[model samples]
Target chain A: MELAKMEALIVDDHPGMRTAMRLTLSNLGVTHSQFAQSANEAIRRIKGQHYDIIVCDYNLGPEQDGQQLLELLRHNNLIDLSMIFIMVTAERAYEKVVSAAELGPDDYLIKPFTAEVFRVRLERVLQKKSAMAPLFPVLQAGDAAKASELCNVLAASHPAYMIDFLRIKAELLMGMGQAEAAQQVFEGIVSERAVPWAKLGLARTLRLQQKDVEAESILEGVISESPEYLAAFDTLASVKDKLGKAGEAQEVLSKAVAISPNTLARQRMMGDVAMRNGDITAAEAAYTTIVEKGRTSFFRDPNDYVNLSRALLECGKNEDAINRLREGRQSFSNAPEAVFAASVMESQAYSQMGKAAAAKEALGRAMALKDSVPMTDELKLDLATACYRSGDEAMGARLMDQVVRNRHEDARLLQRVRKIYTDLGRELEGEQLVQSSTQAVVNLNNQGVLLAKQGNLAGAVELLTEAAAQLPNNQQIVLNAAHAVLTLVNREGWNQDLMLKAKRYLEEVRGSNATHPKLVQLQTLFNDVQNKYGSRV
Target chain B: MSGQDEALLPAMLAASLHEVKNMLGELTLSLDALQQQCPQQAAQIEEMRFVTRQVSDRMVQVLLLYKNDAGVLRPNIEAIPPADLLEEMLMEARSLAGDRLVVSLEGEQAPPYAYFDRYLCEMALMNAIHNALRFAHSRIVIGVGRLGNALCFSVEDDGPGYVPAVLQRAIEPGGHSRDGGTGLGLYFADRVARLHCNNAGECGRVQLDNAGVLGGARFQLILP
Candidate 1:
């Protein structure tokens, strides 16, 4: 952590600015420095080597700016809390840049700052990083419980960073699904001072506890007072969406996008909200922006292409939709899931254009490729739409039943299913399908839980394991199976086969939804069981 | 102006100012490089750098004022140690003053941390230091202390203080003194100060007086 021993990456497109930073770093005893002329180059260098300090210019040519680069680095786990990332901005209106960033840099230095100021800010961040260094490993290991406990210890030890530690503790609590505990922490901070971030955190905790009305009011005040706080706008939009005000949510997102249009996730969210509101024009615009911006970004996903194509088809632009899918096919040719999605959307577009023969061909291709990849709910719904449109009603119904059963708890997806069924004049049948599928899953889950409570761990394990096998994509069932197996192992002994089965189930659920609320608890339970009986197993 | 034009004008100005600030930033960096390469002429180079930064600061002031007029200027507040902030100001002030004037903190002690927007407060205080650098005959003292429940940061110089007209303008809130100077720095300081409000609903303010520890102009940005 000594300045002389630290490796530094100075990212600025302008050679003069880079040289300035290099000279500045050398003066500060940071001799081991590397330079990157653009965000892409910086990313490449960062991927190759570890740096103690990264000084990135805000405007790195035309591609990803410093804020976006920070986001990408954090999102991809290329950087951690230990590294110092300082954003250098020429714009004095840096609030816009700061607020737009979902993951902000450790600190920001305005352009033309003296070497003295730079050193101070760098040392300040380094002090903070060193202070919280102990918690980073625990957090990286996904031990939220230990991390939250460490936050309290660190808070008591590092008085200067008490607020920061509390903030992290609250966020960790929220992530671990302890909403009430997180709310208390946020309330403590809010009572002390109405910091915008703390207020936003409080609103989030409230929303987590289903107090959307209170959350919405706080968000409105935060947004009104700090309009540049883009996170507030995003939270408000979600709160509105949860309250069943899709149109209002779309409007809020539109305002947020207008303020800061470079965020890909926000644009994707706007597209989704607009789609839900049945505003095809707005959806198309948002998705188009995502497609264009996502081309060179690491945050790009295959869903961007599929969503764009879906938006185009919804707008009756069949040729455009086909062209988009073709483009997606070219870009993601090696990705089976992407190819499957493209083929499915292509079939829908062709069927809408009355190309029955071509539609059938695309549907056949999609069905063949579907088994090659794990089917997501979105892709399943799209494929089901294609099947229904191609006059394969039975296939469509089957896909719908699987989707409903797998994602029985997702109200939004259920709404989409209902909408699709209603559009096809099969509302009654759709209701029946949803009710039966939901009831079946509930009964299976309840039976396992009841059996386990009644000292029937063996029965619970067998029942839930079979249920998981039948609904391989069902996160709840897989997690339930993992929980049951872990509990059985914990109570009795570690049976090798059951332990392996539980591990596989946990892995499957994690692969689908890594941030599932129950994931950390189940993972901890699994680890505990392994530690307890690994020698015998 | 049409309503559309009225809305577009500030954005256009902001964009142009942004471009100019960027160019000035490049120029300042080049000046820093020149100063380091030619240490003998560091004073001249530092002067150029100071002017470049002053221009950049002025541009930012105008941009912030425009944002305020457009109702978008919200300060990002945080808990910053006052002593650390003043230490940074001292370093920058010493660099700008070079071998000409002795710039120092008022006391050897550190002040407690306070809640304010570091960037805005830095800009405002640096503006005060720059003015003091221009007018101070021998010394400039920057200090932080408490004014009632508010945190007060003062920049005092050993020279003649502000004139009557400027003092008059300071007392009158929202007074636009279109006279000798545009008074944009003081206006920006006022705006930034007012942006910070305490839990008691007391807004921050700027205080100007001839009573200085250095017997010169004393400018204090008092933030609640």
Candidate 2:
């Protein structure tokens, strides 16, 4: 409560709040403080003095909000490690809270406050800080285990701080895969009232448990109600995209970007969707944004460069696309897949730009460098285009066969594969290849039906699983496989590989149908699997 | 900067007021700290403190009106605890009201956090506390926690409550109550409340009504 010991900096656009706040602080025994009228001045004051506290307003100016400024300070590590940063805000905007929370400030105070209220709020923050102060060194050192122990000790003693403490404990439990404990904690919050974050957190835990339908539904509910909740939108989009609803996912993600343009991952996601849907313009827009904005982010994925550059090649911006990929390859210290992707992209660009000879030459080098990159079905689909363009009909046909085979039961992917082969004047081959894979897929479905009818559940599961492996994108193969296994699983209860195989196949099914028809039954089986085999994943 | 510059005069006025508001905030915090260091000189600093709060309160009021037009005022409602609401409101009230007022807790303690736009509610209470501090001759009292069917909060001043005309206008966002206020504070509050309100049923708001303790104004916000 002594003003002499406390050092503070006040940042606000309003001179009067600063004055009144200063006078009020004086009356309450806080005398020494610095003042800044705007964010620019605040940054200057922050640099000039090591203030014990910083009071910033949420709405700073036209260009930079308080949240953005705080991020800048944090990214730069301008504040001392122990600095008690607080934002003086009056706006109760959700975007502000999310952005504020995302930035991870120490504490924030709203405007037009009296001395008594200020003291109480400060006291609460300081008390929380004091409790954590002893363990701060370990936390600062990034020792989660030690910090968890200290926090756990504090939590057990202080039930008043249980909510805050358990929030951290739940995160640790989640991180440690202590699902049963974390579930009880989350369910406690849920039974009382729905905390969106806790709900989402639990939903994430369910996702880790491979309960895609439950996770997707929770995220969707949050998204529908809180349209501006960007994270929820992203999560829902991710679930949808993973579930093979690329179009729906694209629409939702596009809406999120419209609200608050996702700087990196969202852009990459959008680009991937655009490519899948064959909207080269959108792919270019999203990819270009990611390449420009996310190059320096810790969350930077080299796939953005690869995907965006590929889009550019598809749109016939060969030189620009190749250049972007080349620069990205040099800049990013990522996996070998990135380098391989660059080579693939470069080869595609060269061939598309009418330099077929150069294209093969680059492909030769890429193939030589890496024995073979297990190109994703997406990459293979694109690479087939370059191969066809380079006049390698046999090679192109072979690659197309694999792509079509891998995604046998996926109508959209099948259609896409057909279109690719069609564009290359290989309609007959594409149709024939898809027919073979599709027939095999149809056989597995029929076998499962007959076996289940005949009570040969084991045979039904085995045959369906083989069919699913042959058609990674097929839901029916996976759905029936899980169904057959679910039937067999109870009678033949939790055999490791069989349940694991069933689980893997179910994920593929869920990846194609986030809300699959047979998901509820499958979840019960998954729960059984977890109960039999502890939550170790 | 646009070609139809004359039509944008109001925007310029708003921007100017924003700048003035920033100056008021800087002065308020700086002087309060100075006043604390020089506690013996309370008589000399009270005028500065009063003007600081007045200017800040008015500037905040103006900004509240302008906020609806700004790009960042999107309200996302959540199930907020009454205690969280009180905590946010209390922080704002104390910071802007100065040492002249006493903001405390009252009523049965509800959940600490609520499902409301925490940021928006904070803004509304700030303006309410500023008004309380301006009117009360000696002391202003704020009691928060909960009251009735919903979590009720009140900011009471020993001074007289709102006059009828002003009270009516205060209900409307951007409403001008007596040539004195920009009337933006209450208007913004109403808009903010409506944002959280359900069109299917019920209202979510920060309202200025009778404190029930005295004939003083009580700003009650109930979120369902």
Candidate closest to the true structure, highest DockQ = 1
- How large is the C-alpha RMSD of every model relative to the true structure? 4.2, 8.8
What lDDT score goes with residue B143 in model 2?
59
lDDT of each: 0.84, 0.67
lDDT of 1 by residue, A21-95 (tens): 999999989999999987788889999999999999988877777887888788788998788899998766566
Residue A495 CA displacement from its true place in model 1, Å: 10
Per-residue lDDT over B1-224 for candidate 2, one digit per residue giving the tens place of the 0 to 100 score: 77679658767887788678767766877887898899888756876776676666666556655655664455644443456456656665665555766666564566454446666677666667667766765555655554454555567766677767775543664466534766766676667666664433566666665544656666665555
As for candidate 1, its clashing pairs are none
Whole-model lDDT for model 1 versus the true structure? Answer: 0.84
Score candidate 2 by lDDT: 0.67
CAPRI verdict (incorrect, acceptable, medium, high) for model 2: incorrect
Q: Candidate 1 at residue A514, lDDT?
A: 46
**iRMSD per prediction, in order:** 2.1, 5.9
lDDT of each residue in A357-416, candidate 2, tens digit only = 889987766666445555677777776776777777777777777676566756777888
For model 2, the interface Cα RMSD in angstroms equals 5.9
Clashes of 2: 55
